[model samples]
Target: MDVLQIVAIGLMATVLIGVLKSQRPELAVLLSVAVGVILFLLVLGKIGSIVDIITDLATRAGISMVYLGTIMKIIGIAYIAEFGAQICRDAGEGAVATKIEFAAKILIMVLAVPIVVAVLQSLLKLLG
Candidate 1:
């Protein structure tokens, strides 16, 4: 959307890094991380709006709310997992990142079981 705004933010972050390096290097790292996090939050806000639209459309289409909710939950899991994994990686904890990803996938599968069961039931009814 606003590529210029993103680029400006990137440039501002780069400048901040340069300034922080000379004055307070320790704080500079934290400041850089904070800036990145702020940008990430902005992007996530946009994504949330998109998800809300999808949920609304699903509701209007007479889809099962449980299924729509499950899909949204899956999206949440993916986002949170990515966020946690990124932070872990940034902190030099690759093992922890892997664990986060594994947990996310397992939870997603668990949440999907109901939808899978519903599909199977529909198939069986068709066959009958």
Candidate 2:
């Protein structure tokens, strides 16, 4: 399975990172990022299928594509930000990781604003 492959790659990378950490810390960090990217790419295919399914459901529900798009963007930002933060943390840069997380939160909030407003409007309409 793909998850098994991902786990194996991750375990191998972890071992290599451990070995390289003492002699070549920089390379260890680079290896971490490379493995992360590789894993992300592997799962990227599944993401497309998931997006297609969600899109179909949204269409059937008569939901606006704009909101769906915004939600997808938010999820993307969250995942990307977390990925970046984890990389920073792996490199022993906790401060940088925190900043990355904060920035991601801000971006997610910005993306969610329109959805929140739309929901509020719908609620108001129902109440009225």
Candidate 3:
């Protein structure tokens, strides 16, 4: 879908959420979640194409697929964590959102270990 369509969906959702907040707070939260999911689904196709382009570029550069894959995983973790945190915030759970962010950071660090090891190994070889 186009940007205009996404903007329209967001505007409609915002209107509905504002109206429902006074009368049906729970429904307002649900509407927010639904809108977020729909928007994410709409952009999935674009994400796939971007991934393909990145992979192609990595191949042309003769970069190790392992490094490219780790980078992709890190990006995925960041996006997913942000999405979860936003949903938590929308539902008025700021504490939960903070926890989600903390966990995502740890996971990202774990994923970077391999890349760090490779760099360290290269440096050690140069010193020797």
Backbone Cα, N, C clashes tallied per candidate: 0, 0, 0
Give the Å shift of residue 105 in candidate 1: 0.9
Q: How many backbone clashes does candidate 1 have?
A: 0
lDDT of 3 by residue, 87-113 (tens): 889889999999999999999999999
Per-residue accuracy of model 1 over 4-49 as CA lDDT, tens digit each: 7778888998888788778877776676678778787768768878
* CA RMSD of each candidate after superposition: 3.4, 1.3, 1.3
State every prediction's TM-score relative to the real structure. Answer: 0.72, 0.93, 0.93
Q: Is candidate 1 or candidate 2 better by TM-score?
A: 2
lDDT for every model?
Answer: 0.85, 0.94, 0.95
Model 2 lDDT at residue 73: 92
